[model samples]
Target: MQLFTGLALGSVFVLLAVGLSLIFGLLTVVNFAHGAFYMLGAYAGVFFIGYLGNFWLTLAVVPFAVGAVGLGVERWLVRPLYGRGIDYPLMLTFGLAYILVEVVRILFGAEGMPFDAPDALMGAVNIGVGYFPAYRLFVIAATAVLVIAIWLFLEKTSYGLVIRAGARDSEIVRVLGIDISQVWLLVFGLGTAVAGLAGVLSAPMRSVFPDMGTTVLVEAFVVTVVGGMGSLAGAVVAGLLVGIVVSMTSLFAPAMAEVSMFALMALVLLVRPQGLFGKKGLMG
Candidate 1:
């Protein structure tokens, strides 16, 4: 049961870490506001459930809505700072995160609210070892599908080819007459959209609140780094690893649950600084 729980938790981390890794890998920008986008997804879920009243519909629509917001941010806020050094965009996103959190707090209030899972997903199911929440299994399956879709898109599609080429060398892509700008915008939007998806999925698992993204943001970063910076495969592997470690720790030592992943991260770094799947000389 604990292992299953860890896989579900790790699925969420994988979503966040992949988005973070994609943005940093391609755009060379550290998006501190990724967490804010995630929080928005949860809040959006709250509003959508009240209005639409359909979990599936909300899941489909929230990413586009949040991704649209991300598009606007990229075009208006982050675009102009592209060549001003990495610090400029990083600082901007850091402040943007604070602003987004405050905006949500002002509108939603500081108190946490319950987000119930759909009635169809409320029960437990037997999966060999024990009965586990049906919703958690759904999370695992959903993440797997999405991850596979992502891999296919990146590996087989023309747009994916362009994005991969851009990641390798944007200047060369531009020299080939491709509008790397549009690619960057798309990447940013896609990254934030994935973050929002994770947030919506997470809403039912815990209380929805303004500050909820903060902790997960930190954990996702650890997953990203421990998996090795800018490595999508690394993020996936490390996310599941960290999730299982944290969940198993909670089973035996509840007090150490939160910090266990961090300790794992430190150990991974000590032994393999490039992470499980990271390439050497990635960021110096």
Candidate 2:
């Protein structure tokens, strides 16, 4: 039961890290606003459910809403600044993240707000030694489905090939007559949608709070780094590994659970600065 719960919790990290990895992998956008996007998704889900009283609807709608916002950011904010140094994107996103969080605090208050679990998934299921929350199981299942789906999208599909090619060399892809600009928009939207999905999935598990994504963003970066930046498989493996480590360690040293990731990250960097499954020149 504990193991299952651990994996379930880690799955959220997997989802988040993938989006982060993708955004950075393709655009080198070091999106500090990533967490803000997640928080927005949760808040959007909360709002949707409150008005429509449908979890599934909110699940579908929240991602689209967030994705739309991402599209706008890509066009108006990120695109114009592309000619600038990477520092520009980093600083802009950091500022955006701060402003977004402050707006959330002002509108929603600093306290965590409640989000009801869908009645259909409100119980527990006995997995083996004990019972696990069915809702968490849904999170696990949903993420698994997403992983497989994304794997296919990136591995077996034409769009995925173009994205990968663009990741390798954006200028070359554009020279080859591909509209790399549209691809950038698509990838950014996809990343935001995934982050949004993470937020919606998280709402029932953790109350929606202004800073809910702050810690989560930091942890997602750790998971991405330990897995190897921009490596999807690495994200999945590291997410679960970190979750298990945190859970088991919290049993004895609760206060140290937070710092364990930093320690692990340092150890990993000493051995492999690029990450577990990262390619040799991906960051270059």
By TM-score, the best candidate is 1
Instruction: Give lDDT tens digits, candidate 1, residues 92-145.
Output: 999999999999989989999889999999999999998999998998998888
Candidate 1 global TM-score: 0.98
lDDT of each: 0.91, 0.88
Best by lDDT: 1
Model 1 per-residue lDDT at 248: 97
Give the 10-residue window scoring lowest on summed lDDT in candidate 2: 275-284
- Model 1 error, position 238 (Å): 0.7
TM-score of each: 0.98, 0.96
Residue runs of model 2 more than 4 Å from their true location after superposition: none
Clashing pairs in model 2, backbone N/Cα/C closer than 3 A = 228-275
